[model samples]
Target: MFAARRFSLYERAFGPVVTPITSIRGLLQDFTTTAAYDAAQRSRSNDDYFATIHHISNIVRRDIYMERTLNKMCISKIVNSELVYRVLRSCSRSGIESFRFFNWARTHHPHYDPTTLEFEELLKTLARTGHWETMWKVAHQMKVQNLPISSSIVSFIIEHYGKKDLVDQAVELFNRLKSFNCPQTTEVYNSLLFALCEVKNFQGAYALIRRMLRKGAVPDKKTYSILVNGWCSAGKMREAQEFLEEMSRKGFNPPVRGRDLLIDGLLNAGYLESAKGLVRKMTKEGFVPDVSTFNSLAEAICKSGEIDFCIDLFRDVCKLGLCPDVDTYKIIITAASKVGRIDDAFQILHRSIEEGLRPFPSLYAPILKALCRKGMFDDAFSFFSDMKLKGHPPNRPAYTMLIRMCTRGGRFVEAANYLVEMTELNLLPLSRNFDLVCDGLKNCGKHDLAKRIEQLEISLRGD
Candidate 1:
């Protein structure tokens, strides 16, 4: 009997394995006879659950037949918590009739926590992948189905749609939460405030802030900062100042960065004296001007051609132990040159170099251009040569200026020599430079030299 049993087992093992189709049919037959199956079929009034079951069965692999069988029956009979969650996940994955599915899940599973790990993960995935419209639909469905929407879910929608500038949808969602008597938090207001500020919709932001305040939702430091900075950026410094005063009255000092922004806005809008007064007041109130603040003040002073005041401010900045950056020198040099004080510019340059401040090409470029424009070609060329010796070679603009200077001075040979030097440095002479040299030679009664230069140009072009 043992030998016969062994032979039978071996025969079955080596026989052709039954196909999945055959196994599925047998399982379906068994399911049809089970109590759960009978109850599910009897309870199927609408085709929604049945349709979802059919969709899921058709798509899922045959390997997990039992789980699918359970899922189908679960959807049809009782929309319990676990079963509803499965439907929600299935809806999320299938990307069809998600609203319907989510509504059904929420209505029947009202007691289920919306902040469950599973739901949060799914909502975040939908949000991050830019499925905001779908997420909006899902949130709406949840509300209609009388399920408690999670704050996290609302935050996700707010962040996503807000970033995309879907202001209407974001506001709708926010109102929905408010209608539900959900407590407003700083984070929620911040999200909406940021959305408004990002699009520069100050009116909307101001309205939103007031509304939140009326609802007993106090704005935090960050909230106040956003409004102050936003107003300043929109060139409404008076409004920003008003808000700052209000903040102070409310025992809240504005952030350093926000104050800096306010000061800059005031200065840019031609309120220099007001800005200086504010700086003094802020300093008295223990708000020292940072490097950026001093920098902006210096820039405004220079721009207004108040060089003497700017020089004094520069001294104060140095006294504050803040190392002068390249911009500091630029502002001083630019102002000096603008006011026809080339001597002052040269002195600043010398002092900057002596103080171990390496001159950037940008700094020298503008100064050189200014010098050349003032008919100070000798000084310009000297500066250029010094730059080269200091391992900071003059750029194409400097070389072009030199070419123009030599040609204008009726020194064609000097221009030609400079052109050769430029070529040896692998820099191409501009066509204007060539034209200028030709014109200079011809005007000096050196037509032969002009012709030779033109021939050189032609050869260079061909090569």
Candidate 2:
């Protein structure tokens, strides 16, 4: 009894009991001839058969008697067969976590199978989903069990985890790959560098770039663009510019659009002179300035109250045989008007029209307002009439400006007539315009006319 119990304990602790070959053959023949086994074999391919066998092994392993019997049978039949490797690969892809069993089988029973492709696919899938810990376990299994893992596979894992911001895991895997004598490729360095830069870890990014250079991995234009953008974003315009210069010296042209972005960053940070200088340098480099670049420069100048400089820049653009678009004219007009240069503002309007540029209402509205504000009502009215005759009728805002100017200049009859015209044009008179008309009539001592204006305002409000 004592010997039997000891044997049972050994079997339970280790594996299943090995039946004799005669008994195993009998069992195999019995199952093979059975309708159930025939149907299963006919319906499932060899891949699915192995999958089913592994699943059954798992289930039997949970039972003490069945586990001992199955383990003994597997050992007897040679655990690390080609069929077993396919089964293991399938389990790994299916997330069965039975790879450890395959590791044990391969360790204790030597066998080789050329299924590295499937294993690599599994590793890539796992890595893509940020399963780094599983990836580490699989890598260790592959190394210890003598399974093949390629450099491309290792690099793929590293790149994937790097993109996920799992830098420690990526580095750990990278070190393991180095132990495998895999050289760091340019793709690997680029992935890590970009990842570091994405997190704004410029120190890490810079170090990685230097390390890659030491590894004889030449930095490309993309690498420089990333660093330059990072520096510019961090308000290190000097550093960004220096890097750009370095890139140029190295026979690389960093993207011209990057210069525009750098200029915008500088301008937004109140480094107007640096922004302007950078734009000038970019222009001198024969990089054509995009509309947005010009707009940013113009806006920065206007914000700094450098209206004269903005006008000069627009003039310079014109002198370059580049006809200023309506938007350009609008910017110039706004900048001039903001500085009380009404004459210059109108000069831009006339020039735009003469250049065959269609005048948009937005362009004319502000100019008319500037004229009215400067007490140039006759000039404003004349421009409005000219615009109307030219088939670009004054809009609501323009008519509002005219009505306001008329009332403010004590022209009550003109104000009233303009109000009627605005209504005819379906442009509702604002409350301020009504107030203006009332005040104009009262100021002229026309009390009855003032009352009439107030009554009309009430009627309009009711409608």
Query: Tens digits of per-residue lDDT for model 2 on 212-248?
Result: 7677877665566567666766778777776667656
Cα lDDT of model 1 by residue, 45-87, tens digit: 4466567655653443232343434445454445554544554
Q: Candidate 1 local accuracy as lDDT?
A: 0.66
TM-score of 1: 0.50
TM-score of each: 0.50, 0.50
Clashing pairs in 1: none
lDDT of each: 0.66, 0.67
